[model samples]
Target: MQAKPLTIITQNEKMRNIFSGIDHIVASDSSILLIGETGVGKELFAEYIHRTSPRQMQPFIKVGLSALPAELLESELFGHEKGAFTSAGNEKKGLFELADGGSIFLDDIDDFPYQLQSKLLRVLESRELMRIGGQVSIPINVRLITASKNNLHDLVEKGIFRADLYYRINVVPVDIPPLRDRSEDIPLLAEYYLKKFAPEKEIKIEKEALRKLILYQWPGNVRELRNVVQRISLFASNEIKVEDLPSEIRNDHPMQSLTKACHRCLTNEEMTFEEVVACLEKNLIQQSLKETNGNKTQAAKLLKMNFSTFRDKLKKYLME
Candidate 1:
């Protein structure tokens, strides 16, 4: 099956480069280890890789290790035969078995039990598993993708994670930068979530509101941002203003400073229309460049301009 278009909207140079690298890795059958903070969209990245791989038509199963109790996680991952345990009245298939010929994503792999890591490593190495209380070794052809909020390397050093298992899964490591590190993508992500949650409404975010969003440090990352947008959109009018934002975001000091600047600009009558527009454009471009750490490509993307057009504007403003 043809893969659907990617919904991972990002223009940050680092993320773009990571995606490009992932494109090459997806063609091959290799274990992928995605490392990132919680709510940084590691699971989404795993799904994207699976969707783009040859296993697009096959089943894609996701199991969160942290969510499952240790007592049931083993059976949930490797399945169980009839009478394997008191609750096992019927034979059951595991996530790996269900994901045969496709991909299986194990989220929060760092939280996976230490004892079970060896079994998981064995599966990765042999591509086979034996259901609990069963004699047959069932072969599987599922691609393995594991995600961790904590660094597996450090966990291995601390003896929390199995070193061998870590090596096995770390075949292709993908690190997702936190939202705070890639603030340049904030506007785009906020807009994307806004459209997703309120598709029926043609809502616009005021400049001050957007500045507040961009300035606030998103502790919960993309997930929190999505929730914030959803909440604000629900109560907002045709336009979302600073006051419509959550209290934590609305009261940010940086946002207050930006609002003051905007007020000053509006009150200034000495500045010509062309001069005011030019000044605002220059400031926006500079801000974009600053957020992207001087990466022109990403700065242009943040400004919603073509690379050539952005360069021309830079030259016109004597910014280059």
Candidate 2:
């Protein structure tokens, strides 16, 4: 059997570097821990790792620990023998048993019950498990991949997660960068989604619309962006303009935007005052140009600068 092809579209250099480093790790069967904020595509990363691994041909099972109820989570993960409980009509296989000779992705591992952490740790260490209410141990050979939105170490200190379990699963931790931290990828992702949602239409995103998509902080991350694109595609006839975007995105507060940019400048010790000033000026010129729809005279008037000075600055910044 051959592994199905999986694609992870990203333009960010940091993400590319991560994929490069993960190529080496995928060759081994070490337990992988992916840590990232919600909607940062941790599950997609897990799938990518599995698809690239030697066990790619085998089953890649994914279980969302947070979605499972506390009472049923144990049985869902570890199986149950006949008559194990009132609801049990026959023996059932657990996720670990089902994923034998392959890989198991335990998403939102932090939500896993604290008492069950030891059992998970034991399976990771011994490659075996016992069915619920059954005495016989079942041998298994499954690769482990876990993900968490919060830091497992913090949960450990708070006595919410086991320290030993954290150490066992975090053998090769991968921290996924947030969408805000990788804004450069926004345009690429937006265009991808636009084409995906409206393949039949000759749809194009205007420069100012793309700029707004890039500027607005995507709290829900890529998932939110995808939804927004899909909505736009359904309603937008031909081209997506700035007014076509949602009010929150279009009405980005100038003060908030400036503060965020300044915060980046303040945090970076390597950035000189002159460089920061130049960057800010370039952004202002670009924003003015977008607002005036590339009209140089109007943009100059909006920015309270002489037309000739604006042209000179544009040339200096290579905006021409």
Candidate 3:
């Protein structure tokens, strides 16, 4: 069977720009480092890269490095010979060997064991690996794609990650924006998932419910939105009403509201104080727009700002 092409639904300008850049380098053998929060679909991005690459026909292996126990991680990645360890009865091919002439996506690479990083680096550098307790060297050709939930540079500085290994994997870093950063895509994604989960029924989300989805911060990003849509699709009628939404989303706590408003200030370590203020201002303007249903004049009035100033702010923040 032919492999299906990746369809990442996004109308956001930033995301479009990111994809544009990615398209230019899909054929290159350079390592790609995907940096994003948990549940932001880094694995999806990795698959997209591999699917579009020249090695698409070859095996594409994905491994969540963080999910593996440290003690067994080495054996899993580099494989083992028979009698390599007490439990090793049969020789096995490592993920690298299995992904030879293709791609290997190592998610949560920051969590990869420090001791094993050098071995990984050596394989990537030499294009060869030796099975545990085996004398023969096995050559492999695989494109490396790594994803990290945290900044690998910070980990390197903290002595938790190897700097040399970091440089080797940091050939082309791609930062995926969180769902909140690309709120414009929420409605599109929601509709996409609605049709996906309930193709038989032509269900639709009510305007108010969609507004709540767009306004509420998605801490889990796109993954959270998919789950929400899947849950509601199961019980939704012709139209999904506000009451049909989850209670937490319908009745956001005041503290959660505050956090949402100041999310950039709190979570982003790279943002300066001024940037945080600008973020807050942009968020407030966005909230007003959502509340007034995209009526610029009404949104301006709701924020108690002069129409010209509001318009300028909207243009300044590129919301216009």
RMSD of each: 12.6, 12.5, 10.7
lDDT of 3 by residue, 140-256 (tens): 999999999888998999999999999999999999987878989999999999999999989988898888888766666789889999999999878998899987578553235
The better-scoring model by TM-score among 1 and 2 is 2
What candidate 3 gets wrong by more than 4 Å, as runs, is 252-256, 259-320
Q: What are the clashing pairs of model 2?
A: none
Segments of candidate 1 deviating more than 4 angstroms: 253-320
lDDT for each of the candidates? 0.86, 0.86, 0.87
Two-way TM-score contest, 1 vs 3, winner: 3
Candidate 2, superposed: residue stretches over 4 Å from native: 253-320
Candidate 2 lDDT, 3-91, residue by residue in tens: 78776788899899999989989989999999987788988999999999989989899999999999999899989999999999999
Q: How far off is model 2, as Cα RMSD?
A: 12.5
The sequence of per-residue lDDT tens digits that candidate 1 reaches over residues 183-236 is 999999988988888888978988988988888767678988989999888887
lDDT for residue 236 in candidate 3, whole number 0-100: 86
Q: What is the lDDT of residue 265 in candidate 3?
A: 65
In candidate 1, which residue pairs clash?
A: none
